[model samples]
Target: MQLSLPFTTLLAGVLLALNVNAVPVAQQPRMVTLPLKRMEVRSDEHPRILLQQQINRASKRLALMTGREAPTEAMMTEALRKRVLEVEGPEGLERRRVGLFGATKDKRFNRTGVPKNGKRSPKKGKNAGNAGNAGATGNTGATGNGGAAAGSSAIGGPDSATGVEVANTPTTGNSLGLNIEGPDVGYLATIQMGTPPQNYLILMDSGSADLWVASEACQSTAGGDCGNHQTLGSTSSSSFVASNTPFQVTYGTGAVQGAIIQDDITVAGLTLKAHTFGVTTSETPDFADDSVPFDGLMGLAQSTLSEQQTPTPVESLASAGLISDAITSYKISRAADNLNDGEITFGALDTTKFDQSTLTTVPNVNTQGFWEAALDAITVDGQDTGLQGRTAILDTGTTLIVAPVDDATAVHQLITGSQADGQGGFTVPCDFNQSVALTVGGTVFAIEPQDIALQPPNQDGSCTSGISGGSFGTSNTEWLVGDVFLKNAYYSTDVGKNTVSLAKLV
Candidate 1:
């Protein structure tokens, strides 16, 4: 969407020039942005929550895989937690370490109680035999706080309890909260054939794109743990074609073991000729976490980021020239519950669907994956308060606005007016009130009043709450502008156009 000329000032505008100093440079607003929006799927990179789920599911299959009496669930769970801590330690928290890039209990890192003085020592006291000097641990494999030693492969994902090297990536997430696995690639086709025909609610997560739902073959300790999603394998309308090859995935946080399956997958008016996907048979609660609607998930993110070795169904269709160019858009109308029932468009924004606006361009940090853009500044009552602070990461995954530690604190102070909430965040006295606005790209739009008062009440009647917008994540050094922020504006990412359009939500 076009920012009103009024929204953009000359100095803030993105300026481009050509041909000598002959012509004066034209100025436009520059949106401070992230390169992650650039396309390139780190599908192998799994979120912590998903990792926990995989670990949990893997615990269930450990007995079958190892052919022994598996230890109870809780034991495996604690072990995984400790393992991850050993590798990441607490320092990695600064980067808000999560996924593969951060500390995984699975890998190793550089750290120790004390360094060996500079000269090496010999195992046999030097005079005993001839050889390189060594400390007790033999080769002091580089120093890493997390994961396995530098040279060893960290089993596709992090270790759950203690960062140690293992020969192969664990096919089981048996210890995680939501653990399960089915053969990779082989599981994809089965789920497609299993899901019954009909509309279903689905989580549209960009990370590790693979679309599948729990089948009757699936098991969960949480009693029928699937979301508002339907089971494809259970439906007669459901079709299943099992591939001989198993489906396996190695995520930064965890892994998914399943099989590949291909079947008809449709969203809105869009339908695929033959979509390849996964059917997770492992037991885990991820699919059935809550009443969140959806028969399964839909991976519209780029293929490059896909967790699978095979091409993404969305990207495959886009390449074959099936849809309008792999452009997926959503209009969440919290107005009348459309917030939950919002539509997912495959090709482009259905202009006839809702209020449409001109698109703005954000240079892609990574051109082929999840689209991201620059956010110029964040304001409190129109003040350039958050500008000198951290930038905002506008993401579809998050639900609300999350300011940095400083910014989030200021917002809490302004809204709640409580000294107790100074360094920490507190909710406004339920009766207290104020406007919360964010300056994204160049436009300043205020967050809704209802959204501002986000915290629930406590026993003493003091309404302490989370940082105003979304959860305050210290790991990430930037502010998070999620859907709550997006709802105030019309947004679009045109990979072909190299443009991301934003307009007032109205």
Candidate 2:
């Protein structure tokens, strides 16, 4: 499939690079460790409410695919209940719940209190005592923020968040958790931009590469504006410089437009000098809605996928010799009702994030710059549907598993109760216990049933499914597997080697 380019510009132009001869070259280190912080960006919103909003938005896309008006909430509720019965039989209806959003009062859904901080106390993990070795410095077991007092070389570099030590690295890749909220909302990292460094939380997305932030000039319609989110302004930073490069990117749902600018970006204790990024001058109304938690997005896909036509942070790191490899790994955890957790490792894979030693690596098939691979086959309860040798994009920005119509129909038919909602997706029984698996690199990885449950049941017994039907390419075999499958597996992408590896997370 030809990789879809997200950004489309009205005016034809060229991005003129500015000279940076006077920029001071900063010293960097080999390895850096940053303890990630789990943020309650939307503390007041309930998970069910958020899920409902996502469903509503998805319905619009469904409308486009089916050539019909968006399904009404009541219609969706009834469709969900009917799908459950079709996929799971009469017994499935009996398994329905009457709790919040028809959620099974399952303790997992009602988790409360302050969520666990992503910044785990370094002293609590097996690596707690190993901080000395964990530090970028060699041989010395230097204690970090939460471990022991930072050795003279490490102490007081940055404020300790749960005893996390942020220091300069001589070289090597940096790894940090990519937090998850229920499904694939996104994992966020904090980067300080501008001269007097102001922090901006951005989503690390691999589906497209373009670093952008909301700017002070950002404007939205009456219905758009999410409250309290941060935006950047060049005037606030003494080091900020306008590159006069016009930039814009369109997302699956919205688009952002701005001009390119150069500033410093600090991530995982390493700073990239005179880094070029976008400051959004305009955005779609949806992005300003409360549903979005982060201020901006940071593209981590291959530079080829980038709209800026420049290297991404991960790519820049490699060019500057800050990391050992041009690779990125995602370990997205199930956040449930309270605790949001997960991480992303830049430059190299972190073995501790996975349950297995061997990674199933496959050659990337898309030349346009997506982490796409051939689908060996799909198995449902050990039965092959004969859907094999197809290609699919492994995307983290998406939440559902999307496949072409015929293939999706075949898979849905295998599971007794699944049904097409006339709207682009299937409605499956929340309680259905069928084994759904995907094969790549000659390895079959089973998907946990819970991972396929897109939305909880409502009081009326309606539940949204995690798998949907959408066409990325003309072929029926083209697919898109998002958090529905990613949360259950370990995904690694190496731009340098041009390969994508996946394994059961265990």
Best by TM-score: 2
Per-residue lDDT of 439-476 in model 1, one digit per residue for the tens?
54555556655444433343345443323222223343
For each candidate, give its TM-score against the true structure: 0.52, 0.68
Clashes of 2: 25
Candidate 2 segments exceeding 4 Å error: 1-178, 221-227, 289-291, 337-340, 458-462, 471-474
- lDDT of all predictions: 0.35, 0.54
Q: Report the Cα lDDT for residue 98, model 2.
A: 41
> Model 1, stretches more than 4 Å misplaced?
1-200, 206-208, 221-229, 233-239, 244-256, 289-293, 310-314, 335-341, 352-359, 366-368, 413-425, 431-433, 455-476, 495-499
Best by lDDT: 2
User: Each model's RMSD to truth, in Å?
Assistant: 23.3, 11.7
